[model samples]
Target chain A: DQQVKQNSPSLSVQEGRISILNCDYTNSMFDYFLWYKKYPAEGPTFLISISSIKDKNEDGRFTVFLNKSAKHLSLHIVPSQPGDSAVYFCAASALPNYGQNFVFGPGTRLSVLP
Target chain B: DVKVTQSSRYLVKRTGEKVFLECVQDMDHENMFWYRQDPGLGLRLIYFSYDVKMKEKGDIPEGYSVSREKKERFSLILESASTNQTSMYLCASIPGQGASGANVLTFGAGSRLTVL
Candidate 1:
């Protein structure tokens, strides 16, 4: 069973526009969420994360919003750049367990056209 | 900067051959993990070690084993390689202390294994 899901396989956006990637989770015990970006032939790199206590977390042009009631979370990049083109993965984990095991979604490929 | 290094970037092996993938971390992190990445499968955990000589199986642990003789190094072994086992392997490490849930993981460049 897929506890975490990223329905969108691909997304395209023009530069200077906002890009949004969405993710959903079925496990209620998951309280921590994270986003990672990966390039071709490379391992994924951590991007941003949000705790269950907060609804939104922002760093620079990247923002993550979590809706506990909806069991959904999203990553938003304002003024998307060509360098932002990469596959984004959403991962979720429960508290107390910490890094024991993190469930990852299928990932969304984002393409930014310059 | 915390750096995680994998022993090989690419490897080709025959079916039923024994395969080994090595990972080393310089950050002195206590937690180490192994994962495989495939198209449409994202990253599936194969095994993890919390400390030296400790290991635990992850989501997909079949046909795989792990060894953690030292805190900085973790190894993944395939007793008998199969065609379906060919995939990109990733090694990650996170600090054991000073983080609540889901600390960010630093990953290596990844090792691609192809079994014929």
Candidate 2:
């Protein structure tokens, strides 16, 4: 059973446009959600995160919105750049477990067309 | 910066061969994890360690085992290599207690293994 799911396998967007990526989760215990960006040959790096208490969190060009009632979250990147092309993974964790047992979604490959 | 280093960037082995993937972290983090990433499957946890000589199985620990004899090093072992085990293996580390941001893990580049 996949606790987290990223329905879209891939997405393509033009540069300087807004890109939205969606994710869903089945576990209600998950209170913290995070997004990670991964390049072809590198490890996934932290991008932005949102706590269940808040509906949204923003960092520079990236913004993450959480809808706890719907058990869904979305990541938005404005003015997408060519460098933003990579796989984005959505992960969730609870309080004490934190990063240890994080459940990760399949991932969505984002291609920023230049 | 916290650095997690995987001993090998790539490896190839035949069936039934015993394989070991090593990971070391420079930060004395109490939490260490091993995850495998495959196409269409994302990242799945294999094993994790909280402290020296203490380990816990993750979501997918069927054909794998782990070791953490020291605070800075963790090892993943494949008792018998099989084609199904071929994939990218990643190691990550995080501090035990702190702000929520500390939950962010520092990951190694990854080790791509091919079991034929």
Candidate 3:
């Protein structure tokens, strides 16, 4: 069973526009959510994260919003650049067993067109 | 800057052969993990260790095993390699404690394994 799901397999957006990626989780125990950006031939790097306590978290051009009631989260990148083109993964972890297990979504390929 | 290094970037093996993928982290992190990445499946955890001599099976542990003999190194072993095992393997590390534990997961470039 896939606890975390990224319904969209791919997404395309124009440069200088906002690019939004969505994710949903079936487990209510998950309290921490994170987003990672991965490029070809490279490892996925941390982008932004949101705790269940808060509804949103922002870092520079990236913003992550969490809706606990709906078990949904979204990552928004403002003024998307060509460099933002990559596969984005959404991951969730429950507290107390934080480092022990992390469930990852299938991932969404984001293409920022210049 | 935390650095996670995988011993090999690519490897090829034949069916029934034993394969080992090694990973090392320089940041002295107590938590280490192994994940397999496929085209659309994203990253699925195979195994993880929280300390030296300690290990735990992750979501997908079938046909895979891991070892953490030292504090800085973790190894994933495939007892009998099969064609279906061919995929990109990734290793990650994070501090054992604190909120960053679940937030930051530094990953190695990845090792592409091909089981013929």
Candidate 4:
């Protein structure tokens, strides 16, 4: 079962524009959500995260918004740059203990046009 | 910076050949994981070790096995590699500190393997 899903496989946006990526989860037990960015031939790097307790978390150019009711979350990048072009993955974990089962979405490849 | 290193960045092997992929973490993490990344499939966990000499099968463990004799090193072995096993394999680590109940994963560059 695909607990986490990224409906869009690819997206493109103009440089300096806002970029939005969406993710949905079927497991309501998951309370911690994270986003990772990956470049070609490289490992995934952590970008931002949000807890189910809050609706939104912001860090400079990146912001993550969580809607528990909808079982959905989104990552928003303002002033998107060419460097932001990469595959973004959304992951979720229950976090009930130290070592919890984590699940990842299929991932969305974003292309920022210069 | 926490470093999770995968010994091989790329490898090619023939079908029915035994293959081994090594991973090491410098940060003394108690939890380590192995995953395979494929197009449209994302990352699927193959195995994970929570402690030295301890291992657990992840979502997809068929045709693969792993060993964690030491805390810092985790190895994935393919008894007999098959063409379908060709894909990008990733290793990740998580500190046991369990500081704030966070399950953040530190990943390595990944190993791309091809089975002919």
lDDT of 1 by residue, B1-116 (tens): 78999989999999999999999999888899999999898899999999999999998999999999999999999999999999999999998767532388889999999999
Ranking by lDDT: 1, 2, 4, 3
Local accuracy of candidate 3 as per-residue lDDT tens digits, A2-113: 8999999999999999999999999999999989999988889989888899999999999999999999999999989999999999999897554566789999999999
Worst 10 residues of 4 chain B by lDDT: B95-104
Runs in model 4 with CA error above 4 Å?
A97-100, B100-102
lDDT of 4 by residue, B1-116 (tens): 89999999999999999999999999888889999999898899999998999999999999999999999999999999999999999999887754532478889999999999
Assess each prediction's global lDDT (C-alpha) against the native. Answer: 0.93, 0.93, 0.92, 0.93
Lowest lDDT block of 10, candidate 2 chain A: A93-102
lDDT of 2 at B79: 100
**Model 4 docking grade:** medium
Q: What lDDT score is found at residue A90 in candidate 4?
A: 95
Report per-candidate TM-score of chain A alone. 0.97, 0.97, 0.97, 0.96
- Tens digits of per-residue lDDT, candidate 1, A32-82, equal 999999998888999999989999999999999999999999999998999
TM-score of each: 0.97, 0.97, 0.96, 0.97
C-alpha RMSD of each candidate structure in angstroms = 1.4, 1.1, 1.3, 1.2
lDDT of 3 by residue, B35-109 (tens): 999987889989999889988889889999998999999999999999999999999998867745445788999
Please give, for residues A16-111, the per-residue lDDT of candidate 4 as tens digits: 999999999999999999999999999999999888889999999999999999999999999999999999999998876344387999999999
What pairs collide in candidate 2? Answer: none
Per-candidate clashes come to 0, 0, 0, 0
Q: After superposition, how far is residue A112 of candidate 3 from its true place, in Å?
A: 0.6
Instruction: Give the winner by lDDT: 1 or 3.
Output: 1
